[model samples]
Target: MPLRRVAALLLEPMSVFEYAVAAEVFGLDRTDDGVPAFEFITAGPAPGEPVALNTGGAIVPTHRWSDVLDADLVVLPASEILEEYPGELLEVIREAHARGATVLTICSGAFTLAATGLLDGKRATTHWRYLDLLARRYPEVDVTIDVLYVDNGSLITGAGTSAGIDACLHLVRRELGAGVANAIARRMVVPPQRDGGQRQYVRTPVPECTADSLQPVLLHVLDNLHEPHSVTSLAQRAVMSERTFARRFSAETGTTPHRWLLQQRVLRARELLERSDASVEQVAADVGFSSAALLRSHFQTIVGTSPQRYRRAFSTT
Candidate 1:
């Protein structure tokens, strides 16, 4: 079904950035770009009531909880991560989902969805810092910590901050099409689709290494992704023994050398697929995979989709 109407649910002590993510994606009038316009409205617990924001300001929502029942999509933006959500708001979300409206959450908004028990026994994600807390609080929900977002049919959850943009665009692509999503992304000056997951943004507790220690080797590998690489070769370039290099590599990068190389290759393949008119075989070769078959295998594992399908969905051409 086409997503013609969208309603954003605002709670007290709201996050301005998360609220803006929804407004930017659905509320803006983009009819000139041939993108369909949505009837976007902000709904709160009390209609026409001013709610305090974490940014030291307040917003007066024009609609009440009942306004969301007819919306094609219902968005829950970040608010205080409370142990309990308002029962009235939860009922609204439950009714919307039961009526086939897509439910989406950004950041701590997952807590609100979780409160409705909709995320139970479902795969979901939120900001990396809160993964453990969320899992411990709700054991029934499968909280994925690595990915930027999780899409479970009618339910979608995004990680912190900018990841909300990725989730919003993903929904646009799913309900509308790649063309409309890409047009919105181009106007926002962001990539239509980002490669890899939130794992790349996670903070590791390992001690920092000297600036020049492994920087050169990492840069060289990125520049020479098509070339064969191994621990011995990379260690030699870094002027360290293989054993020492392996240990330090893991300490500095939070992953083994082989895994890091594979991730880089997959990222390069995604770039080529999106912006270049390259066949799967050529893209595989360019990214250092032995064959198109092997590339497909790794690409599917890392990206959750085949290269051909990814290109079909996101190719700029």
Candidate 2:
């Protein structure tokens, strides 16, 4: 019932695009349908000075870092480089987080926030290209490299540059409602929703399928997830030795073929569990698992919950 106060922390060499995104969504008073308007302010390390941006532009902040203690949400725009995160910046972020403000970061800006130890032991994402580095840099942080973004309640991190828009839209939906977020998306001509599980841009597209390559075989395996197939049989169908087929499959998918196939089966089982009233045994059979026990074992291992619990949690509406 009260106005939400949002502050975007503008650091030197700020990303104008990310900053503009924060302003458009939170700073502007666009409440034509009676949605609550937020009290938005740009804040800098120092009070009331023009902050330099990477887009050859400057924006003067309305407040200093001290004013951020009262903010409900604080956005950290993407940092220009991975190493520019300073101790002062880390302290500001850490203090804001300690005060219970939702700290959100876009792309590599997560690196800066993570420097404060806020994201440690929490699931988060950053630009997918820098994912391995993020994981390596902050081994305590649980990095999910594939998702569009991760929402850890108190802290949110987005993958890549454009995924920042997705995360911001998601925040609008979470804080206001879907109607407000959809209206903003319509105005921007962007898709209203992309699941957090959606893939970011693939770094290097797989080489085009060759006559002897495993792409065709992989497709068939995916299409028939319920089928019982063996490595020997698959290699025979492709007219290659098992070792050669495994090597080529790994090159194409960045994972072993067996692991990929098992993951797909787990995915299929989850869909059935979530969408259908079938018992765990039925879903297991439908997804090529030999038994419900095997299904429950793998489902809990991969989906992080029992099949029955997953079904109950995500039953079709």
Candidate 3:
């Protein structure tokens, strides 16, 4: 399916930000800018009823719950984490998924989708605040952590407010093409893509000179990804002993030098694949992977897809 129709299911008490996120991504017409426009609708239990918002004001949906069934994609904004969601709402989600509609949850909206039992045995996540509760309540679901979003094909879950945008854009990139997603991202002034597996937050909340001082080194490494470099070499360049550099690097980047290097290499490879007419082998070499085989392994690990398939979906050329 090309994802032409989209309906957001709004429930009370409404979450203004997540609802706004859905509206901004799908409700707006972006066709003039080369982004595909969706037949966006706000659906509720009653077509013309008002749903109270958590922030005070209420939103009136334009369509009834039945309208959600016709959508190619169903968006669920954040919902109240009550003892249970409405039976009718849960049924609608199940029916929607059963009919091949992609269901997306923003923030605590995962709780509503989880109630339908569709998320059982599938990897999913909500906001970090609710991860443990979601796992405890739905014992069958494979609850993931530390990631912004999880895409289990038709059922997708976003971590928090901004993650919703990333998830929606990813779906656009997955179905329509990266060009469309890029156009939308540019219009919104956000990154076109962030791997769903990227960490939601770093353990070190405070900024430190260690991370700041390493900026030059990080930038240099990015500029010369094709060159061989290790922690020792990076340490030498930073004018720090290897042991201190290694400790600071972990504190600053939240990952070891080798892992961060691999992540950066994959990111560069993605750009090359999307923007240039380069072979996988060439992209591998350009991004510092020793061979195409090594690039494929790392690309698949970080991106959840092969380079060729990613290019097929995202390539501008």
Candidate 4:
């Protein structure tokens, strides 16, 4: 098999963290262990131009965006400013997709992809702070505000700065499986997988006077995420009907109460798995799962890896 080609779009005013993530994942030579390595190249909307990035550094592209007709993966690193996205940049993304390349974005880079209309009617995400702007600007897109990243086959969008590491690892895991991704994460000294979706960011503060509202209930749920609790019990404790509780919870948290709680549980479980010497069964019980089998199922499905593998790969020595 041939080595896959990956190109990162070095857009102007790029974020250093986002750019570093792509470089770390794709730019490094990892063929020492016979793993498939990507031919990583930094490209620009125009060739041979100095692209300003937020890192106080500038990148000069080896190729123009038009030169990437056959790249397997293309990345748009995050930026701080979304309102300054240029139309020419959107055109390049459109042309890239026309050739069937997988497009990935980090953090606010979703704003650039959303401008292309390719994210229309598709589930996508970005930095939690910009979800509302993305929703208002592109009402047709089903913006998932509570995901670390959304992989829609050909298009991928990440949540925040460090979440880009999770998104890239997820992509590596999908294309190369757990072992390869874990190896790469080890080389980079980052957790191969981070549990908990983007719901953690959705927990915005509520007024102190209205503390009895969903805020107090959410705090209770977070505090007891490792316990078996349900929406009905939480609603009863909060002195509101289930229907009213659900509505208010969604309005305040940007996701259903059930989904939010599950994410918190997963988050707590991952922490234990990474930090403790407990078996999967013990960790599962501590995190509210009925059994190790159930924990494994959810861990594989949502955490993107098995518990044992995550522990072995990420446990601090």
RMSD (Å) per prediction:
7.1, 7.9, 9.2, 6.0
Per-candidate local distance difference test: 0.89, 0.78, 0.86, 0.80
Candidate 2, which ten residues in sequence have the lowest lDDT sum? Answer: 198-207
The residue-by-residue lDDT of candidate 2 on 2-95, one tens digit each, is 2299899887888888888788778777678555788998888777688998878688998887788778899998767656576776787788
**Residue range 204-225, candidate 4, lDDT tens digits:** 3422324456677777776776
lDDT of 3 by residue, 257-317 (tens): 8998898888888889889999999999999989999999988777766788778767899
TM-score of each: 0.68, 0.66, 0.64, 0.67
> What TM-score should be assigned to candidate 1?
0.68
Tell me how far candidate 1 lies from the true structure as C-alpha RMSD in angstroms: 7.1
Q: Give the residue spans of candidate 1 off by over 4 A.
A: 207-317
Residue 317 C-alpha lDDT in model 4 = 40
Residue 209 miss distance in model 4 (angstroms): 4.2
